[model samples]
Target chain A: DAGITQSPRYKITETGRQVTLMCHQTWSHSYMFWYRQDLGHGLRLIYYSAAADITDKGEVPDGYVVSRSKTENFPLTLESATRSQTSVYFCASSEQGRETQYFGPGTRLLVL
Target chain B: DQQVKQNSPSLSVQEGRISILNCDYTNSMFDYFLWYKKYPAEGPTFLISISSIKDKNEDGRFTVFLNKSAKHLSLHIVPSQPGDSAVYFCAADRYNSGGYQKVTFGTGTKLQVIP
Candidate 1:
């Protein structure tokens, strides 16, 4: 597809384990972001990448790690997953500085 | 603190009626606002937006009104239809510390239309 896509639409992992959520965009956008959506918290930014190899923390980046080695891909890794990390993860891409973000289908992760 | 707030959790309206969804912001630094609609299992789609300079922006059945002084904005849908049933989100864009545009989104409001 030409738009952004997230791998493992649904995932189940145990606490203390490591998990990585993948995001790939075909538009070659310069900005890629990772957000987690929960019941009360709409969409809190976990991490954002301005360009390849340039990533920064977002609102809720405590337990999440993100890296962008290519313009088309931005993956989020949970070093040590916890129950608090169980939420729907969304990946989005924009042209440069947050003009408009196009989001992926989302990855539903459950921690046991 | 939540910069963007959507107080209504859900709203129900009859077809062909007016549907109004309101949003409030605590930060005056936000210069841009946008509304997005999302369905289950799908990503949110852009609905309408209004810049701080403009008070109102309309597109088809969707219209967005911005009140800078009150730090409030609203999305109004006229002659609402059943197809408009979905979750609507309000977002604000502010200049972050690093000079990048930062977006903060509201919890979202679910609208149900009865035909």
Candidate 2:
């Protein structure tokens, strides 16, 4: 509805396959972020976009790719998914500054 | 090297008691701190935040205390209820010289409020 939403709440894919997680925010926030949550490690930022066409890599960005062609949408793509990529993916959006963020329900991905 | 750390992996408290979750950070440049609560199969929602300049910030039953000298922050929930059971994550906002802002989150502490 009015908040952020992620597509395919649950996904199962094979290793080496490509998977893309979609994130859409209705609030029209200027900053969109992608984070992955694992067991020992907390939520690590994968990528963040300040505005349309402006993106930056976060802590763990080696295996992930992101693009923000539109302000309302930011998609994360895994070129070659591996078993280590299996984790809960979250999408968040915020205003100009990177202070408060609203998160989506999250997408659970299992790479077999 | 983890910048943010939540030493307590899990905490249990009886209902109507106080629940304390602690977080520590190694970066002194982090100016802002925030706490987020996440339920199973759901994204984390912002709970509360306190700037480095302030020692304490409170909202209703939730209060966040920041100790800048010790580089520690804590979230205290009074009169805990079952609904308060969730994973709480503490995040630090760091602004780099490049004019970019980044958030570093701790491993998270799972709190179970026994009702």
Candidate 3:
């Protein structure tokens, strides 16, 4: 109950449908990140927020959007999901950019 | 291109033997290295980390060694146990030219401790 958490541990959606993955952390870390893990690609950062309302893109950010209105919440949204977007998403948090990150349980999404 | 790489996709070792996992990075800017372990249906958890200034860092049965000159790092698990069977990831951290601190992870190596 004290660490980070992700909602909808498993999700199935149709292509072109909008879906959102929620991430919450009780640590109130300044840095929160969203990463997608796919076969052969490992974990690629989609977006990261340094603090409330300040976010940046990582290696892959297209088709995905993220926002951080509260320090404890960072939610990722897919305006129109595609089959290619099917993968496991992980949310991580750190006190600062240089600190060690703690990850959440992850959300598995299947876009058909 | 993959900046961080784990050449071995999987490793198997005897329960009582030592297990070694290797990782290589193409970026010299990476100053902090970390190792994470993950079990099925779970997020990866931090196991050990070492700063660029140190060649090695140890925590209980897990030890991480960094060879800055070679741009390589390794994780050694002594007296490996079945519980250690999981996916191990090697990650690197650095402040990029864009002024944002970034962390990159390797493809991951699945370690199996056979009894």
- Over A1-112, each residue of candidate 3 has an lDDT whose tens digit, in order, gives 8999999999999999999999999998999999998878778899998899989999999999999999999999999999999999999999988888999999999999
Question: Could you give candidate 3's per-residue lDDT for residues B21-73 as a string of tens digits?
Answer: 99999999999999999999999999999999999999999999999999999
The lDDT per prediction is 0.92, 0.94, 0.94
What's model 2's TM-score?
0.98
**Per-residue lDDT over B71-91 for candidate 2, one digit per residue giving the tens place of the 0 to 100 score:** 999999998999999999999
**Runs off by more than 4 Å, candidate 2:** none
Residue-by-residue lDDT tens digits, candidate 2, A3-52: 99999899999999999999999988999999999998989999988889
Question: Positional deviation of A83 in candidate 2, in angstroms?
Answer: 0.8
Candidates ranked by DockQ:
2, 3, 1
Quote the lDDT for A25 in model 3: 99
DockQ, all models: 0.76, 0.84, 0.82
Docking quality category of candidate 1 according to DockQ thresholds = medium
True contacts kept of 3: 0.77
> Which residue pairs collide in model 2, if any?
none
Which parts of model 3 are misplaced by more than 4 Å? none
In angstroms, the error of model 3 at A96 is 1.5
Error of 2 at A70 (Å): 0.3
